[model samples]
Target: MQRRLADNITSDHLSCPICRDTLKDPKLLPCDHSICFECLTQLIESSRRFNKFSCPVDRREITASSYTLSAEQWASSFPTDELSLLLLQTISGDTKTETKLKDGILCSDHPQNGCDFFCFGCYKIICSECAVENHRDTECNCKNFKNCADLAREKLRDAYDEIENLIITGQDIVFKEIDKDQLLLQSRQQIRSTIKKLKTIVQDFEKMINRKCVDILSKVDSVTNVEELKKRTEGIVKDLKRVRDEVELSKSLTSTKDILTVLSKIPESLQKNTDLLYSLAVSDNPIELKLELNEKFLNLCETLIDQPIGTVHVVPADTIDFEDTEATVCSKRIKFSSDVLPLRALELDPFLAIQLDPSESENKITARFTGVIIHGHSIIAIDNANFKVQRFRDTIENQFIDEVLIQGIYDITNIHENDDVLVTSPGKQSRLIRLSTYNSLSIISEKVTENAYFSISQLPDCTFAVISHSSPTSSKKRVNFDWSRGVTSHIDIIDVDGNVLKHFSENFLCEPNEFGDPFIMPLKSICCLPNGNIVVSIETKTNSFISCFNQNARVKWTYDLNDTPEGVCFDDGKIYVFLRESKAVRVLSVDGDLKPVSTLRLPNYFGDGYSLFVGRNLLSVIDRTELIRLYKLQSC
Candidate 1:
């Protein structure tokens, strides 16, 4: 008995219905039917009389309006079925000779059965029968060849494109190097020419000095004395000219062989200094070539004139070192530094204090400050009651430089090496706001959303990650405040423009109210680590924990706070968790062990710690009332 066509050729499904052959650049129509570009073009031409073509499989009218003017253009107007093309490339043994060689390798033990699945564990291919019989264990998980082939083709294409880009990059680098070499040669020639001109100036100065000295000596009463002075001056001029010539020769000895040496010195010449070598290359500072008489000329003038002749004296130029100019501008004090001691060992004594009370001169501060962060030289504080953000100079607590009004300011965080702050607002329409660190009044970027955002953090790449819920802000109620507050069902990773790049949800992970099984602690504060992982402080009425999630929002590890964890922060690979009930800040390592490093007790004035910020080697926290305290971090 003969096998059916479908049984013999597994890729029959990938073939075009009209041509009954493997697809080539298959175009998909509105009816979900795909056909080869060539076949589509022929169908369109045949139906030109009616100005309409129909799908071969669906028999639906394919209007000319749906496609473009030309047949090639019309084919491109529709989406290409890349899956079918990849399938055809895999089974037809065409396009690539490597694919043909790969097809020849069948199942080793069961040669009759084609190897369809790739076992990742054994790093070998196996037939369905063999996979079921020999590799039944989960460790020997197998991937279908059809899917793996498509992935392999995509990876190879990416690698090939990368190599092509590298070739272009390499060519550009070679051309740039060649240009630099030419520039280096030009610099060498210019410097040599300059040295020659300087030598000529010195020779001319020597002749002038000799003539002046002879004229002065001629004033002597004795003719023998005048003659002796002339001989001495002529000898001095000749020696000076010879020295100039020797110096010029020394400069000219820098041949093409010393091109590397010249190139190496190019950076020094470009630096801020009017040295002879630098002046030759740079046009900003002009060189002054002048030769003046030594102290001996002044003595000769005084003696020859007899009546204490008024002599012109040349003063030496002061040497300036460019490196020391910065220090000269302003003297810097010695910076104080000490080893970071354990939180328990160091005292949380109030290093600095600021009153968060409303001021008549500036924008009124809210009774409570929701979020506080020390970004660079400014302390950013969020006023949830007034929907405002206040900026104060970190060094001087009294100076209030700026204030920004946001619609619903929930929390604020600083982006890595960026001057913008990421603020979260859970309002009628939840959104993420990027406010300027300098001028807190302006909004740099805002991403409005339908869901209420709890907290926002910036990844190392400057993209933002926000914890939000699926339900609208209006759905929240005070009666179910605990459940509603912990309603952070999903974490959305978005770009500057607010486009959600990636997101993961807790819905499938667990039901919002369900507990004890798949742990569900609604996310409160979020902080993205230097690594792409995120640390979120999650809490319930009774239970609290700090969970670290990978880029995909999958929980990598979780450390139980035991008490109600309020705010979360990450700095220098350490995770800081604020315990609202315990009235302390717990520092823990993010490693596998999740070891508790140290604990910091809240100060007397701090009623319930709401927010914590760790940056610029300083720690700032917002207290219950109108008080913001700062502490200098020390570790041993």
Candidate 2:
């Protein structure tokens, strides 16, 4: 009877009421029912808003005394089902013992005893007699077979818990991927439908043209037939009139010889007219009718056929793979040297020089580039003269691609992570514009600011650092006056919504002169570093310099330059400063006193460098002469 009852213990008896799976980490509920720990935690989280959860088996509501406990804690509050765990272990051990006993696994030294205990150090099973003799040492670390088995089972349970967590995370990722796939499929279907409609339109246009051609040809044929009939009738009437006049003249003569001559001539003339009429009736010659089409219209049609109706712009996928171990090892092994490395002069080979196309501008004004940036494989520039933003191919030819009109734009900067750009328009109502460059140049959002921002730069934390210059007063005469006399500028750190987070006004490149009056330099272009430092170019009548400021707006360091600085940008741990008078770019180290590294010289004919953009292996500069020059960095 006991054997039959043991055999009748089915999987349903061991299964949890919530999951219907064999009990694993089973917990006892208040209603005397058991559930899987993970399942209970999920249920508790689902009912957290109500502060009560109903049991799956009895549908009884259970409320926690305090809502401060997390879902895992609430699940853990329930006691573990020790009886189920014990029964599971017993069943597992019984099966293994039966197999070993049937196989007669006895110790070699003590053949009469069955091997039960396991010696961890010796890695072998032993009988009781052998355990007392060989595995008696404390270092052996021997334990009973049942205890060792239970410990192994606990480790397996921990591994299974980790696997369950992974399964949940993987399911979420798969669902997201499926959603993306559906969107792509929908887009493809839309494109196909659009193409089909375009094809139908073209076919209809062709049919209309064919109908017009047929109508024209039919009109031409009718005109040719009428003109031929009119010419033949006119010739016959003229011949008959001549013969009748001869007969009338002969009858008035009143002489036999005259009458005979007139009658003979009349027969000859009648025969001649008859012959002419016969020839006209029998003639099968076709009139040479040519239908001439307009040359310009035909050429236009050919051009339209040759060109594409729409463009397909392919955006690159944004994905990055990184290894944590490799990065950690590299960080530990690589150390930057304290000593300043030798300056490496990079040769700037002239790649291409593109003159701005005058026909592209609506106002027919000279191109005046105010800002320029390298986005992906194209060079984008703002033409202040025409209020246009133009894009050019970043190849050797540097061909013009397209342009969009944006009024009052002062500066532009690219956001690398997404193919978007931030543009600043400084005026009475200054605004910051965000544009999406994925499909085409289009405005996404705009934020109005209280202060007029001359230049804008993106920080590492995704905020913006903008510079606002105070307009000069008419009372000021001298160009290189002190701060109290000349115009000053301030920097404001603003979030995406155009709300100013931090403002710095007082300590911006301020130094006292011999008379104890502070000298404030006028700020020009600005850029941000990876470490959140703000660098701004300061231009003065005598000389120019670039200053680096920390997060608190305090000047960290300043590097003096010989010529006036116009534009500034940072790339690869270095600062590039464009000098207007010198018409060259100066590279400075971002560390250790901001020392000068090297100078990249431009052509003598190149105009004053207004803006500069650096790419991975290319450098572009726009000048005041309506020319954009590209250069290849030899050893970048």
Q: What's the CA error at residue 404 for candidate 2, in Å?
A: 2.2
Q: Per-prediction TM-score, please?
A: 0.41, 0.43
Model 1, 1-636: lDDT tens per residue?
Answer: 113432344344556788887677888787767788888888777765455777778688876664348776666688776444544444444555244346756678966455667776676777654665577575874556655777557757988999999999999999878755664565567567877897898689789988987876664433334466566656655655565565455567657655555556545543523243332333454444334657887896688678632343332212111111110001232222211222222246666667755766366754467788877777778767777787888888657878877776787777667687778888766787877766445787887765666667778887888777553255444223346454446788887666788877754332245555454666667788877987777654555666666786456665554567777778876777777765777776655544555666545644666667877667777754567788776551
Candidate lDDT values, in order: 0.64, 0.71
What is candidate 2's lDDT per residue for 213-295, written digit by digit as tens? 89998888766465787788798988899888888788689689889977877777888888887765545666567778989
Instruction: Report how far off residue 362 is in candidate 2 (Å).
Output: 1.8
Instruction: For candidate 2, give the lDDT of residue 326.
Output: 12
User: Which pairs of residues have clashing backbones in candidate 2?
Assistant: none
Least accurate stretch of 10 residues (summed lDDT) in model 1?
A: 320-329
Residue-level lDDT for 386 in candidate 1: 70
Query: Can you tell me which runs of candidate 1 are displaced by over 4 Å?
Result: 1-346, 359-365, 470-488, 507-521, 591-593, 623-625
